[model samples]
Structure formats: structure tokens, C-alpha cells
Target: MKILFNKPYKSGNELKYIADSIESGKISGDGIYTKKCHDFLENKFGYNKALLTTSCTDALEMAAILIDVKPGDEVIMPSYTFVSTANAFVLRGAKLVFADSKKDHPGIDEEAIETLITSKTKAIVPVHYAGVACDMDKIMELAKNYDLFVIEDAAQAIDSYYLGKDGLKKPLGSIGHLAAFSFHETKNIISGEGGMLVVNDEKFLKRAEIIREKGTNRSAFFRGEIDKYGWVDVGSSFLPSDIIAAYLYAQLESLEFIQDRRKSIWNRYDNAFRGVLDSKHDITLPFIPSHATNNAHMYYLVCSSIDERKKLLAYLKSNGILAVFHYLSLHESKFFNGKHEGLNLKESDRYTNCLVRLPLFVELGEQEQDFIIKHINEFYKKK
Candidate 1:
């Protein structure tokens, strides 16, 4: 009974679509498959414009570029997120004001964001951790009052929804001025290494295309909007190949099936662990707020302490299960510690040291999952 951390799931048409893309002789970006993908996302999600990128990191970089992030500009984000969330702005010479996570969940604290905003603050990047929504209403109000850009890091938020104060539910990516989503192998939808830049505000559409096409109006040239295209703006080669889009399209077509299974797996884990593990007073399960809809992207538990988490992770691995820990708090990381200004991010640090992710892929079988649950139970029982 050997179970790894993640296994990429394939829809029936992935290879077929990849073959189709190769046969079309335009394996480059924004080909037939690419157009199909763009259409699918825009039509389904109601995003103003969705551009496929080589990776989510590239999409975030593109968002930073679109907003004109410059030196000394401050961007606020959770210290508990992946480096890419901070690195995108850091590459643009912006100062990162690391925010703390909520005590109940790993999402950024909406209450703390207002205090972090200063005269130099330019953007607020709220990461929807584990497909759970952050307090977007508060964050959006703050963004409006302060005139700051909102970039939703929806890397794990696909198929997730956030209910607003107006009682309307909006897709996570659609609410922000700009957003980035990942289709990496580890995510629910995947294309090996692929991503999408969702431009909710239409102002960035044309420029977003130009930036994605290596600072050229190549997208316009291809669309017959212009006779020729050349260097136009500061940008990069962010667009992904049509092959990647093709594979992603196959996955998108079966999005419901993938989400259904993932949610089922997530619910099973929640039901199994909620009362059982939580009753022991040494572990805590994920907490979902009423305003957010779960996409079940991941299932992680917070142990009582760093030592307990490490020992439990070791115990699981020794039993042929590959449970894993998540990100370290970026503020406390060696690269940023000196520059972090020494703000106390207790909740972020707690998640960094204590959180452990269990395997929750689409193909993880009932028996295999049971084995994993049994091992986890055994590990805790002995302690």
C-alpha cells in the first residue's frame, strides 16, 4: 500500500487533443486549441478575458506588469503563501508587506490588511488558500477606500465561489481586478505546467495580450486588427504552447467529474477527521466559512505543535504514505527575514510549522484512502 502525495488525473481526451494540436501544425501559443480554452474559460466563468500562460508564476508576473508595479511600491499578501505570490511583485522591485493569516484558517486576515496599507501600498494579493475563500467583502472595501489593486491568487481556487454581502455569489477570480489560476499537475485541473491570467477589468485586455506575446501586438496581428506587429510594451513570453492548452481543454471538458470526485474525497476526509481527530484536542481540521464554497483542492490538518507535526509526518511516511507539509512563512524565511520589518505573524507561523497535507487526489481509491486514514489514526493513537 504505497501512496504518493499527488497523482495527476487525466480526462479521456487529453492525449487525443494533444495529437490534434500537433496535427494542426500550430503548436505555438493562441492556436486553435488555445482559442478553445480561452473561450471555455470566458464563457463558463464569465471572466472578462482569460489568457493562458506558461505557469501561474508567469500569470502573476503579467498581473504585476499590467498594474505597473515599480520600485518601493508596497504589496500586501499572506506570509503563509507560496513564494511565487510574493516573488512576482518582488521581481518588479516592489516591497512586500507580509500579512498574517486568520487564526481559524490559513487565508490572509482581512482585519489586519487595513493596518498594513500605507501611502506606498499599491496592491493587495489575497490567496484563496486550499480553495477556501478569504473575507473578500472586507478586502474589497479596503481596496476601494485605499485605491489599491486586488489580485486574487486563485491558484487553488478553481471551481470555487465566494458569496458577497449583496447575497450574490461570484467566482473567486472574477471578483478581483486581476487574478491568476494554475493548471499545474498538482491542482484539480492540470496541463503539466500551465496557468491562466484572468483579467476581470477589461482595461488590461489588449495590453495583457501584448505582454503575453513578448511585448508585441502579435495577438492583434493574428486577429487581423493590425497588418503588422512589433515591440509595444514591457512584457515577457508568458503564453503557453497550444499543446498545453489542448491538454487543459480536455481536463476542462471534464471539470465537473474532477471536481465532484475531489469534493467527495475532501468531504470524506473532513467527516473522518472532524469529530474524531478534533476531539483529541491535539489536532485541528480545516475551517470553511459560510460565505465560501469549497473546491476541495486540499485537505490539511494543524497539529498542536511543530514537534507533533514532524513526528506524525514521519510516522505516515514510514507506513508507506507520503503525507507532506506546506509552505514556510515567507516573512521568516532567510531571504526575507532581514527585510520583513519584524512584524509578528503568529498565525502564519503556526500554519507553517503545524500544517500537514494528506493525499487527496482524484484517483486515490476507497481502499487506499482507508489505509491512509487508518495509518493516521494509528499514528495519533500511539501518541
Candidate 2:
């Protein structure tokens, strides 16, 4: 069998949508499809405003702008997250205060955040790793006590929901003052290369529009069909091309079915690996919290150490399964290494050294899953 992400889910009528956008002769940003995406997110997530961006990276950058992050300011986020989560603030001249991940999951430990917050701390960026919702309640409580702004890095949480204390499931991006999402090709859904910014606060909504449109009220001008628009604020061209928006709209329309199928594949892996996972102290299953819903973005196993993980990686490769690993713990990377391990980030490094992600694309088949599991079982049994 050929190596693939092993999950199977087509995003949308990508080519057709793009072609339609081209035929419409308005392939610029903020066209029909862009409005559709805005409406889709606003209605689905109860967002006060939704802006399509070139990428989640851009959405995050916009958040940095809206918060007016200044030089020497510090932004707190987990060590085990995609760089974009912190890079946005870093670009705005803010220092990244890398917090450790929770012992149970990749999400940042809320307890650790308080100790990191200081007079120089301007904002907190919480990443919801692997489409699993972070402890937003705890994070929010901390933010409230500190009087800080919460910008959720919801890059993997497009359709995922956070289970609130009231027993209701809230949209992932809707909880934070501002949140970002990805539409990369590898994600559950895609617009080729597009993303979104969902802002809950009306105060920043107007400024966000201008920043997304190169510091102009172009969005308003476009709506007014104005004869001219001038520089209105400090912004950039973060909006995605109209064709990109069209493709994303197609994916959004099929989100329900796409999410359902992805969940099934995730379940398959979870069920198949349960025995091998719990059968030993060395191999561990992904630890998801009770209140969080798995979006099936990935299925990863935790080994005992970095050496064991590397050996397993070699074994999986030799067996023709493209099982992979992730997140080098930005805390320890050559470019980002630091001396102060204040919170005893033993758990963060523990996560980096141990976690092994399995192949989990939407189009992955059952037979392939069985083959992958078979190799995994053999690796464990013989060891």
C-alpha cells in the first residue's frame, strides 16, 4: 500500500470554485465567496465579526495589531505549539514567554500561566493543539484576574467545540476575544491556502477590517461601492484572494459530513490501538480531557522517552507506515533556547521527547489502518 495520511476526506469542489471565481471576473479579495465565509463563521460560531485572511499566520498577526502589542511586551503561550502562535506577537516586538504544557495533554497548563504573567505581560496566546480544546475556562479566569486579553490560537479548532461548565458546548474560537484558524491543505478542511480571524469584541472589529485591508477602510468602501478609498489605519494585505475564498466556501458547505468522516477514522485508530496502548507502561495513548471534543485532527502515541520514540519511528518507516512525530518544544530549540526553566518544564520536554503521531488524513482507508495497526502491534509485542 502507498503511504498517505491514511485518512480520506475531499475538501470541496476546489477547481470548480476557483474557475467560477475566475469566470465572475472579480478575483480580488473580499468578493462573493469571502462574504460567504464571513457569514458561515459568524453564524456558526456566533462571532461578532469574521475576516478571511491569507493564512492563520495573518489572522494571528492581526490579533497582535488589535492588541497594540509593543516592543518589550511579553506574550505567554505554550512551548508545544506551532510557531505561528507565538511568532505573530514576536513580530510585533513582543517577547514570547514560553509556558509548559499540561501533564495530561499538549495544552498549556493554566496554573503555569499565572506565574508567567507580570507587569510586562500584555496578552496571553493559548493554543488548542491537535483540534482539542484547551481549558478555556481556566485560561479565561486567569486572564480576568490579570486583566489580560485572551487570543486563542484555534488553528486546529475549526469545527470543534469547548464543553462549558454549564454542560453546553461552545464554539472553540468564540470564547476568546480574538481567535485564529487554519485552512491549509493538510487540515481537516482547506481553501488551498486560506485562514480566518474571528473577533468577539465589537471594539476591535472596525480596526481589524482596516488592518486586514492595508490600513484602509476598503472593506467599507467595497461595501459602499465608493469611488475611492485612502489609508485609514496601519494594516496589511492579509485578505485571501477571491478564488481562495470560493474554494473555502465549498469546503465549509460540506463541513458537517467531512467532520463526521474524520471522527470515524479517529475512532478507528483509537479503538484499534487501545489494547496495545494500555497493555504496557511504555506505550501511551493520547490523553484528551473529558470536557474537550476530539476533532480527529491527528492520532498520536506517547512513548516513554525520546530514544524509544526515535526507534519506533525507524520501525514504522521500515514497515512502510509513515508514522511521524512533532513539536520540538520551542523552549529547547537552537533559536529559542532559554536559561530560565522557571516552572520546571520537565513535562514540556517530556511531551517533546515522547509523542509520536500516526498517519491520520481523512482519506485513509480501513485496510491501510489494519496494516498500520498490525505493524504497530508487532513492534510492541516483540519489544
Candidate 3:
């Protein structure tokens, strides 16, 4: 009866991995298993170079460092993302240009992005929330046309894909010049606390390596390749221990199963709540475009308005379901105000008010799902 995030976290072989790390005596960072995980991601996903980091926030900070963000440099992103999306650039003193979300979802609106660009605009951080692929084609088109750097915040987008003009589906993180991933316990996989940065461009790979190594040329040095690797540049200690990577590797080896299990749960929720799709035009389910194949990261409901959504939240929590809400609009957050004054992000505001995220994880059983659905349906009936 405890439908607590029934996720099958990294229990199997995690202790063994840690034990091995201890025996190896190289448990600090970037060991053999780190290389194995890095190789798996590169070969499996087509990323040119992948660097394991402490968290998605660390990877994002690495991207910000690579971009050399500074005061007056503007980084555009949606107002609906986790604060880490904007905080990464803000740490480097970059100006934030917040854009509205799309008419249908929380992903950034492409039309809105173009309008926000100016000479001071240096980068675009497109967060693919809920593992759903944002309109990458349109975003890429804008990047090329405007000569802007693209940093994809693929925190929830592991197996998700987008169909390009070639008609073949491209992996989510592989397409962007730079992408960040999260392997936090809350995700489909659990590494306890870890993340990665994927570098797509050949030119950026060298700099990325140095940044991950505390601003040194140590990566080359480790290869018996360099004479001396010193404090070569400005960087931070972003790498995670090989112990965490080993656990992540075990979880990744079962990626297909994890994805399949989560997908089944997502379908269950979608089917049980199917009738609510058209219950009222104002209250709708997630509308995914044909081109996007999400990783089943989250399943949420969009209600009629802010107040209606709030009432449902109270009802669900009161019933012990642990249902939660999503991000408050970042543009209106305490940190950044006044800078982007005329930036009225309407869809972001709507999502901030109406979106209610339900729990989704591997091992969410039929009874648990039924109870959740039962409560949800009951609330709608009384409403």
C-alpha cells in the first residue's frame, strides 16, 4: 500500500562495485569503470566525447566554463526549467533572458527564442523536460542561422529521440553541440548522485577534458602523452568517483529493461486516465508531437487552471499519494527580476500554475497504480 517512489534503484552489485573500488585503491575519480561507462555512452549514443561529473549541475557548470560566460553575456532558456539550468550560467555572471514555453508543453518556444537574441546573446540552454525531445530541428536551425552556441539540458532525456528530416530518429543528447545528463536517484536509473557531460564537437572535446580535470592538461598526461600537466586553466573538480560510475554501469546495462518497465507504467497511467483527455478542452493530458519519443521520465496532468490544479494537489496528497507540482517560473524567482522586464512568458506561467506531476518509477505495481488512479478519478468525479 506504500506507493512510495517504487523505483528499483541501484541495489544489485552496487556494494560489490564499491568494494572493487576500495580494493583497486583508485577510488578517487576517473578509474577503469569510469572509462567503461564513458565508452558505453560514446559508442551507444554516438556522442563524440563524454565526461562523467558529480551531478548534472556540475556538467552544466563545465559547459558554462567552456563558453566563458561573463557579465553582459546573455544565456536564453525557458522559465519553466529547474533553477540549475539558469544557475549554471548565472554562476559565471551571465545575464538571463527568459523565454516562454510552447503553447502545448514546457519546452522552450522556438519563435520566442529568436526574438530574445541580441549581440550580447551568447548561448541557448534548451532543457528537454520530462525526457520529451524539444523541437531540436527548429532549435538547431535557429542556432545555425544566428550563430549561437547550443547547450542542451538533457537531464531527463536519456533514451528519448527526435525524428530529423532524414526520417531516422536521432538520440536526444547526441544532436546538440553540448549536452548534460543526470543520473540522480530520482531518474530512471540511480547512481545515488552523479551526472555526465557530452561534447559533440571535436573542437570542444579538448577544452572539456581540461575543465573536468580541475583546469589541468592531466588527461593527456595520464595517457603517458604529456611532459607535464599543471594548473593550466581555470576549472573546478567536477569528476565523480569511479565507484559511482560502476553502479551507474550496472543500471545502464539494464537500460532497455528499465525503459520498458517505465514505459509500461506510463501507458498504464495514460490508459487509466484516457477518459480525462477530452473531459474538458481546458483540462488536457500531455500532447506529444509525433517526432518526439520520450524516455517515460514523468507523467503529469494539466488541469483547467491554477486553482483547479491546487485543489487536486491537496486531495491527492491528503490521500497519501505523494503527488507533487513542478517548477515556479524562474523569471519571477527571487534571484533574477527587473533584468528581463518585458519578457512575458505566458505558457510558462500556465504550466507553472496547472501542471501536476505524478510519481513514476520502475516496480510501480498494478495495485499501487490502481490506487493512485482510483483517487485521481474520485477527485475528478467530485469536482
Q: Pick the candidate with the highest lDDT.
A: 1
Predicted candidate 3 versus true structure: per-residue lDDT over 54-92, tens digit per residue: 999999999998888888899989999999898899899
Q: Which 10-residue span in candidate 1 carries the lowest summed lDDT? A: 334-343
lDDT of 2 by residue, 15-40 (tens): 78889889988899988788888898
Clash numbers, per candidate: 0, 10, 0
* Native RMSD of candidate 1 (Å): 0.8
**Which residue runs does candidate 2 get wrong by more than 4 Å?**
6-12, 225-227, 339-341
Ranking by TM-score: 1, 3, 2
What TM-score goes with each of the models?
A: 0.99, 0.96, 0.97
Candidate 1: tens digits of C-alpha lDDT, residues 1-383: 79999999988899999999999999988889999999999998899999999999999999999999999999999999999999999999999999999999999999999989999999999999999999899989999999999999999999899999999999889999999999999999999999999998889999999999889999898889999999989888998999999999999999999999999998888888888899985688999999999999999999999999999999998889999999999998899858987479999999999999999999999999999999888888888
Residue 300, model 2: Cα distance from true site in angstroms: 0.6
By TM-score, is 2 or 3 better?
3
Native-vs-model 3 lDDT?
A: 0.86
Worst 10 residues of 2 by lDDT: 3-12
Candidate 3 deviant stretches above 4 angstroms: 5-8
